[model samples]
Target: MSWLRALKATARSGLTVERRRLEPLVAARAALGLALVVGATLALFGPGAAISSAFGAFQAAIATFQRSWRPRPTLALASGASLAVSTFLGYVTGAGTHPGPFLALLAVWTFLSGLAWAAGPTIGIIASSNVAMMLVTVTLPTSVAAAAGHAAMIAVGGVVQAALVVLLPVRRWGAQRDALADALAAEADYARRLRQDPVAPFDPVPLMTARSAAAVTPRQARSRPAELHGARGLAERIRPVLASLADPAVGAPAEGPQRDRVRELLAAAASVLDAAAHAIRHGEPVDLPPGAVAALRTPDTVAILDGPPRRAAVRLAALLDDVVETAEPRTETRTPTPTETRTQTPTAAGAQTRTQTASQSQSQPKSRARPTLLRLAPVVAARMRAELRPDSPVFRHAVRVTAVTTAGYVLGSALPLGHGYWAPMASVMVMRPDFSQTYSRSVARFGGTLVGVALATAVVEVADPGVYASASLAVACAFGMYLLMRTGYAVSQVCVAAYVVFLLGMGGSAWTQTVYERVVLTLLGGVLAMLAYAVYPAWETPRLRGRLADWLVTDGRYAASVVAHYANPAGHVCADVREALLDTRAARIAWQEALDRATHEPVRHRGLSRAAADDAGHALAQFGRVAMLMEAHLPERGAPPVPAAATLAEALRRSTERGGKAVRERRVPEWDELRETVANSGPLMTDPLLRKGAGLLLDALDDLSESLAPPTDRA
Candidate 1:
């Protein structure tokens, strides 16, 4: 009986996991199948080609509807309106081959079928791509029998694909949750190690946190809706999961050795949430306390909290050990070593002293708010205009990128290779400025195509003579592709390939036996795309370096502004102060990422470019730390404590205009006096009310100027 219970438990767990994994794929399949079936069924009642063409017209209508709802919808009624008109035009152009009036009628229905809100743009793009292909089929004659056969096939295919998708939906949110948890755990471990030693030479905590946080932001944003709306209503279910974190009972640690560890983990998670919230609210970066690293590394600490958990336990344990190891100082236990053991008193003391000095050196501490007048737009816009003028290097670079890629594509399309098909695709694949992004797209394309082809082949084998089976297969393929759309390249390739293959088979192709030819064509397209990417790669370093520089420059300016305002009285002080503080925070994060990418390959990005990116990132982060200190002291924006702050601000502004390197060198006017006044203003910052307004700025000015200094080539 005990054994039987164990078996039951195992079976239940296995089934749950399997179901979770397959849900998203199932949903995609179902959507694809449904769309295909509807189109194919319409074909059975008319000439198969005419019905297919009409369905294409419907797709175009949907696409138009989608594009109409962007950046605030205008006078346009729906995307489908354009599709209907286009279909009519196509029909008119081929009136000698097919009745122009029938084509016009087909256009109206297509338009009506595509009126979905929010999804029109994406659907419209898909629709437009196929519209031309479908219009070509207008040459074929139409009748009730052909349309009926087409419609029936489409309906069947849609049903089957939709069934599959609904039955085996993919677990996108679950994956996101897992990723989020891992990122948090890694950062926590790093912090914990930092805590143990407090003084050992340590890796900067903010850098790792920034990277992890970066990854989490995009995933979290993407997963939010899916979690709210996905299959089994998992999204709805996860709402409570996110809420449960707020509940003291859910995230709080039970008392024991692991209690502290647990609290740290919870704090880390909270930090992530806070960072995400701040980014959304004020568009600023969230920086965690270095101590959070220790808590993340402890396995016993991480294992207790388990909701939508995957690998959280193992990661937690490893993180804890790592923290303990990295932060802990090395001590030499000199056991009485034979003859040499007795003479160690003075030497041991000296070694101990040296170790203490090294440890102290390592623990050095490294390193918000509200809305403002929307009226800063003119001032900001002017600044933007000056900064973004076309004569600058930035505009020149942008134009160059556009021209190169456009030229590459035109050349490819014009070439004879792969019947002029491989060239255009090649141009897109090869000429992308971002190699990684381009590669990812290419991989997705190939994989998606393969999966599509396989599915199409299966449907063809099962499809019977006449139009019903053909239409059904086509519908099924469409639904499947739609459902598996998010997972990456493979899913995309599978659906598209399958749908096209099914369409070919349904149209009664003698080429059904020549499957290899289709495969070769796709391969050829992928190869060309890869080649285009390799020939003239646009390295991501230059843009990344520029962003880093911009962030630092902006941060320094914001710091000075906040300080100046604190030194003087102003209206809308809180509003103004918060705006400056938040701006600093935001620029800091942008700087860090740019720094990381710029420094990722030192060999590839050398000399001035490398130094510029690195110095800028560090400077911004340091400047941010200063701003945080200021904000902490001055909660209010309007109070002025120190009169000298305004003078200091003027000096800093001049230095900033000269650039960070100059500012770091103390080259600005009245630099020494400003520094002295800010340093001496500490006592004034301690007053409760005055501290909230004026003291903050003084602290910020002093800290920021120092933090933005560049690193040396010290051994």
Candidate 2:
């Protein structure tokens, strides 16, 4: 009955959570996305059919590798450099050759293409750019014409996408910014909540889910550049929000009432947010600090009122007042420096005794050293092997996605007015881990394409490519824009688009006719690619949830083990727990990105979410109680001994280890002798050394538990 009730409750809660939070974003994206798709398609069909065909082919190739590529800084640079080198080498070698060996170029292209496939789009672009430059410089007439055709098609697509973004009714910027901000707030809130309630079923699953949704899309991190009008304002806003996370305290200070008061206030603030989120949908009144609501309404509240509560109104007043008013870490002043240095008397006799003590302490601590990573190595390796090998289904799927996308682009290149270009660009944007990622990519792609198109049009109108000097200047502007890669992807697309137009005009050959043709091809490729992504998306939600679960379980177990041994004395239990906690935390962080990808896969995500919640709740409960127990066991003069706790501690340790092994491996070990040994060990605290050892172990245990039980995921 209890289990049944729990299931029902979880299901009900999931529905409410999805409805109140995720649904709106989905709705908004869908509506705006449709418009973008239709507009881009129509624009492309109106221009040069051949240009559109080539543009589509390029997008298809990019789409094939879309799953592997990202706009990450290092990846971009590496890809760009590779492309530049390849282009120079290919051009120099092939320029004098008879049409160059198609197979050799294909082989080199394949290898570089594979790297682009593995590394991502930025690298692929570098390779593509090189291919363009090489063809133009190498093969006299036919090859150069083909290279120009490819470049022109790509630029057209860029312009069209950018135009769609600007003209469409979409809150693209707001969505991206909101996603990042929410993630930060969620981290703080989860930490605070878990710290206070420990056992109230703390689950990082929801937090992971939220994060996966947010991370699938990223905005440009740079501040305003010369061309971007309001980019500086956005950067300024984000910077302050990040800055607010810095801790006011520099170091650990003397424990006092002020510290206690501060803890109380922070706990209070967390509770208020939880209550608000819980109540808002139910139409119930939620209580908060006096100024929380008013604070949420202010611009300053952006940093605080994010995450689950979904309001900045309450955060500004709470944080500024709380953080500013809290007393700083107190400094401890000793007597004179000379006296402090001399306090550790090292007379010959004393030195010998001290050496013996140090050796003993070291030995004791060493017994507790259990390398957790080593224990889990087999499991991790096995999982990785399964996921990455040739036989793995996911790998096969990735290959298929790439092949299909590439085929589309190649076919599109044969078309007339470049109306096929939109299909390929869409393929690149939509081929992510989930719908959210697809949406984000689509939005960015659309915006970038449109901007590129507009820029190209403006340049052509001004320069009128019949004049070689004017056309050259236009090309230079496009190249300059490409160099400003630090700007948002959207802006960079515009620059590249304009450059495409210059290249298409064939250096003052003809301008007006080419601009329209370029736009048409790009739009054609983008549309086709988008269709592929929408039809069969692979989500990232499940894996993210799994990571959260592991962290929670590891943290909880460590806390329990630490507290159990601390309360009793003279056992290796606390040390073991601490080791386990450390291992779990490390593992949890490593798997975070994988888990985020899983969040998009609904079927797998549900299972991961459940596990994450269960583990987190257990961890919070264990850590909370352990923290309390540690505080209770604080050193004092002549405190009463905990009777018979030593025997209990040993028994618990044996039981825990046996049970843990069973849980992890599904096998029971022979434990008759271990149980007897635990039974024989009695009254541990009676020995002074044992008592001291227990006290020493407390610090490590606490640190491990806290580290494992972090409130939010940090990547």
Candidate 3:
């Protein structure tokens, strides 16, 4: 019953659709790609070639529809090339006389391809396509000449799929822009909550998700639109200021024009942020309310504001100025000199000017010039080196996949089961780098295959579909597979299984026997994948401590950098601050990922209880808010540094180092001594607002320390 409930929950969550607009587009592209390949093959080489080409086309279409946030044409070409090469190799090996050498070759290919997962989703999908192609190719019997021809046909199929991608490039920047808008909207909501209640607990999920979406390689950042960069930077700058403004001790003058003016300013700032978000999302002009800009510059506004509120106003002004700059285009104009006007007739002068303009345009660099592989060499090298390490999960998973697939292949061949390659293919699909995904996928694949086999068998028995009807069924299933691939593994697998069954039926296989063989072989492969994981798993709990420690260290560095900026406010340190922030964001992302993986694992594999883990996560989130507040209030030029700023900085670094060690050692550190030091440090600076902000920081740090301590008693 528990298992049934879990399955039901999984289906419900997986089937829930967001972004409905994109689904039909994806499904259409996939179906069209398949249709083109089948149609071309049937016209050029007849029905037999069409049947073979349909298999290649289905694989290519799957690769095409694998959604990536950053879509690159080069990635599509590379995927096609990989599928071609892998299919050729599989055909050659299967045609050989000896089974031992063929198995050895398969193992080596599986291991090498599995390592590609570390490079990211695009490369991972290409690798998976290679494996899928190989599984199908090895089942066919062909001579070397026939194999080469088939490989060329398969390459053509991939090219057609890639062409479809290039022809329709909708929503290229939609995901990135939407993410930035959501971040700004979240910040605006946070500000509103602060205005309503100064002590509301902040939820960091939206900001974190946005940051994750905004993260890109240096190469990507350089190529992205200037407006997007400005929006993200401005949103990050606004967050910390909002946190500072929420401090209750930052008081406004009571019952006066000043109080009313400050309240109005805060409201205006929030509205401006919301407007900026809307402008960015919709690509429309950002126009501030009539008096909003004038209000910021008014005498009353400056007179009433001080400390945190003043700082907030300054940041808000800067953000609005940036919005205006990005929204307006700049054009340079020049006047003709007296000598130039006198030297020629009007027509001659106009022609000369046109020639100069054309020459200048010709000299300018082209933005669309192809990105050289030389530029990517270093990144590829670094990823390869990282995955080569013995302790890397990618390396371990590669080895595990190689071993499992090899054993499955050997077992299938020894048994008298028809279509033995299905067993290894199942194993290939189910295995993943993480334990939880591998387990979940194994279950989903098996269950979905069973359901799919039953449906396919029933349809074939009732209709007795000929080649044309079977081909139509295959194409429809291909479309459905790509549509639900991202939405749910189980549902996608159902489509995949049905498509394969129809594809085989088109090649004149007995429907009932083919279905029986597929069900048995898939079940065997799934069980093998699960067993492999159980024997050698990459459990997340053991790595969680290290991930948490890494986050602490990076957060400490970011906090330290912010404090140092106050001591030497004149120094130009924006680059250093930005780098530190990026590092902190990266570390936070890693910690969150590790925690999520741990949550999915069984209790026996988890080092900490779920409740304890949740408590620690909450503590870390609170600490992040305090860090943002400290960063928000860096001293301006000629402004005096808080007297206790240096002391607080030192304490923060020491406490973070201590906390990291405690996590690494899996034991509690003594926080009483640090608590006493912070309590006795006294009034934290001259400005009442800075003092209050420091007090909040100390309280957050204390909470973090307490959370790191072990529970007093466990059941």
Give each model's whole-structure lDDT: 0.38, 0.37, 0.66
Clashes of 2: 89
Clash count, candidate 1? 91
Q: What's the distance in Å from true for residue 560, model 2?
A: 8.7
Error of 3 at 390 (Å): 4.6
lDDT of 2 by residue, 444-467 (tens): 545565666677677667755543
Off by over 4 Å in 3: 1-22, 46-57, 64-67, 94-96, 197-229, 249-275, 284-305, 324-378, 570-573, 605-607, 641-651, 671-694, 713-715
Candidate 1 on 1-715: residue-level lDDT in tens?
1334433442332222111233444444344434443454454444354345434432332232221212111111122233334434444444334444534433432332222111222432433233333233333334434333333332333234424433444442333334333433434343344233221122233333322222322223443432111111111112122222222222223354444544454455434333332322232233333444333433343245443121222222222222222222223431111112112223332343324323422342111111121332354345434434444432232233334333433443344432222222322322222344344455555555565666566655665435556556555555554444444445545665665555555555533542554465445545554454344444445555345445555665766675665576442224555556445546555555445533332125432345544443454454454443343233222444566556556655654445545443432212454456446654554333233333333344344444344345221
Model 2, position 224: C-alpha lDDT score: 12
Badly placed stretches (over 4 Å) of model 2 are 1-81, 84-387, 390-401, 418-435, 463-488, 503-520, 531-537, 542-545, 552-715
Best by TM-score: 3
Ranking by TM-score: 3, 1, 2
TM-score of each: 0.49, 0.42, 0.82
Error (Å) of candidate 2 at residue 631 is 13
Model 3: per-residue lDDT, tens digit, 1-715?
A: 1334534543444344434334678678868878888777767875555655676667766665554544444455566566667767777775346677778788888987778788775566567557856777655536777777667777777777778877876555666677777887887787677666654565555665555556555466676665465455556666666666555545444445645655666666667667767766776666555455555545454456664565555455544455444433232422221122222222332344334323422342222222344565577657856898778888888888898888888787777877877888888887888876776777788878888878888898899998778888888888888787776678788888898888888777778767878888888988898788768777777888788777776776677666656655632225576677778777887888888866665534245556666666666666666666666666544667655656666666787778788877877544554455456655555655445555665666556556666566322
Instruction: List the RMSD of every prediction in angstroms.
Output: 18.1, 16.9, 9.0
Output the lDDT of residue 349, model 2. Answer: 30
Name the 10 consecutive residues with the lowest summed lDDT in model 3.
335-344
